[model samples]
Target: MTSLVVPPSTLGSSFFSWFASSSSNNSLNPPKIFRKTPSNAVALYPISLKSSNRPSFDRFPRTKIWATLGEKDPNGAAPLQVVEESSSSIVDEEVEKSVKVLKDAAKTRRVAAEEVLSALSVLEKAKLDPSKFFNTLGGTSSPGRTWMLIFTAEKKLEKGRYFPLTAIQRFDAAGKRIENGVFLGPIGSLTFEGRMSWKNRILAFIFERIRIKFGPLEPLEISLGKKDEREPSSKDPFFIWFYVDEELAVARGRSGGTAFWCRCRRVNT
Candidate 1:
């Protein structure tokens, strides 16, 4: 069960409530809510940071991280910060933060863990159908559990496909980040490393797993679908497509010799 809120015009599309598994210990504090900005592209916003504010998609980072408040909710957070991919060019604020955090990943895994989990929760609330995600927290040495992101492309138990995931860096025996995974998503399971920002301003992902043929370049940065913009017909099978420069790039999946798109819909129950 999830919650739906009215679309805040300041943002773009409607907002979705974040729900955590009952097993979670944090409850006294409210979970963050993400909004989808449908400015011909996808960007997320956080409710607490809402104002008569907006951001330009052209200036954001390819992948970045921002922090929200634990004070009842995220506050003074970038709400809409820029992401910088050029790790060496440290010219952007978002880039500087990403570098600092990734550098201290050993001591900051606890923080990164929570940030990514918040993202996972938002995606779940968005009700991305036919897809389900779960995260295991035991770092590299946790024996049965290793720190990994798992998403089931076609989640029905009857039949489907599950992708393998890896972070931007491999974990050392001490669970410190080395070399930087930077492109975490679907490694054979990543590259599609994107999420609704704390400000609900950008929902982005990458597609660069080489297995079959169908697309260009190893990694392609693309926008995501907004809430209302995703009026997927419940009665009809929905085909998920990645937006390339604001245009829909239908993603096709292959089985045996034939290729077809994955059928899906918003799990709005």
Candidate 2:
């Protein structure tokens, strides 16, 4: 036999060709390779081969995998999850704050209503005292004029006090001091007579029957009584009537063809 000697170049080329052919065939039926080196024992490695045009390893280690998956920066997928949680927490806090504000406002309104009721109670109590009562009368017109008739109860009693129990005062249309006097005890009745002039007689007629309301106390109904022909008057006749409360507490005195028509009430302090 001829002496067989393997050249280094031929051995290297043959190893490469065998590797390629084995790789191509191994694509359909993948092979398990076992290599024994001088220092290491048997090392088993699995090599998956694809088409020759493709990369040697079917799937290679991906570069910067975590970065590509958005996991390394503040704006990454994990950071987005944290942001969503934080945003939800903030919205919940705001909702709770708004609820608290509404509750506080409702409580304040209730307290205010209670305070108003307390004030009204005090005012109502003050109105019950007869001694604290005072009456004021006034009238107004264009180029307006106003008159005030005040009546205050006396603190002490004396001899002359019983004789003239009440007092009376008169004011002119100009609101200037015209007359002031006292009603004698034997006078029996008092009367205030006047005429209301208007460009339209119909207005005066309607106004003559108007009613004055006093908050839950009573209503004073004004009506025409009799026409006094003797007194020279304008087209609007002298409308006469007695003022009285619904409860009839301060009623007009009816005796000796005389009637007391003025009505009075206690004022709330």
Candidate 3:
């Protein structure tokens, strides 16, 4: 999971912290599905989570409409009561339309911050099926997809900004691998690579190694932990997906911050 956080350094922009080496990353149960890839098949980076504060939302009250009974029964039974429709049903329809607008605007990055935020809020409350989200995001079978970070919403969703740096995340569902990288163009880059476990709506991962390259210096590889380390579970830092389509995806990190990524071609570096 690529969770945006404010780093200790003065980069003036937030960078995802690498998956930390902690007990939370461990899981007693092995992943339900597993695949093996070459040890050196990837050069990835890690992202640590920083829990952000979010405001609470209120649920809409449901309005009930009683159905009228039009039968004159000899037994004199009470008329049956029925609910015509639920308030959520109505909201769901509107939410679907709003999501379409979001997907359309994401293509050109022309959507206003306010509009994007509003759409995201609606998605959060939309209660869309998680199974569909997972299937479309990572794929049904061999999930191999890349997404480019577009916008990040701050605490309380009061402020929003476009990502200043180039950050990309790769999910290999078949191989159970995840790679997150931030490129500095000609300056340098940071990458974290490791195993990922996908369950329901969450994608959990534990980065095992980090690669750093600065300027003319040779890239350095630092092992974060032993290969036999436990797999990450839901208790670990993760992203709860709200919406996913071919064009874009919206998710909220464990840190409470919300972000949306647009599907992009894989980055080979």
Q: Give Cα-based local distance difference scores for all models.
A: 0.21, 0.21, 0.58
Q: How close is candidate 2 to the true structure, as a TM-score?
A: 0.16
Best by TM-score: 3
Give stretches of model 1 more than 4 Å off.
Answer: 1-17, 20-57, 60-90, 102-269
Better of 1 and 3 by TM-score: 3
Question: RMSD in Å for candidate 1, one decimal?
Answer: 23.3
- Alpha carbon lDDT of residue 218, candidate 3? 81
| Model 2 lDDT per residue over 1-63, tens place | 100111111111001011111112311111212111111111111111111211111122233
The CA lDDT at 16 in model 2 is 9
lDDT, model 2, position 118: 30
Please state every model's RMSD to the true fold in angstroms.
23.3, 55.1, 11.7
The clash count for each model shown is 23, 0, 10
By how many angstroms RMSD does model 2 differ from the true structure?
Answer: 55.1
lDDT value for model 2: 0.21
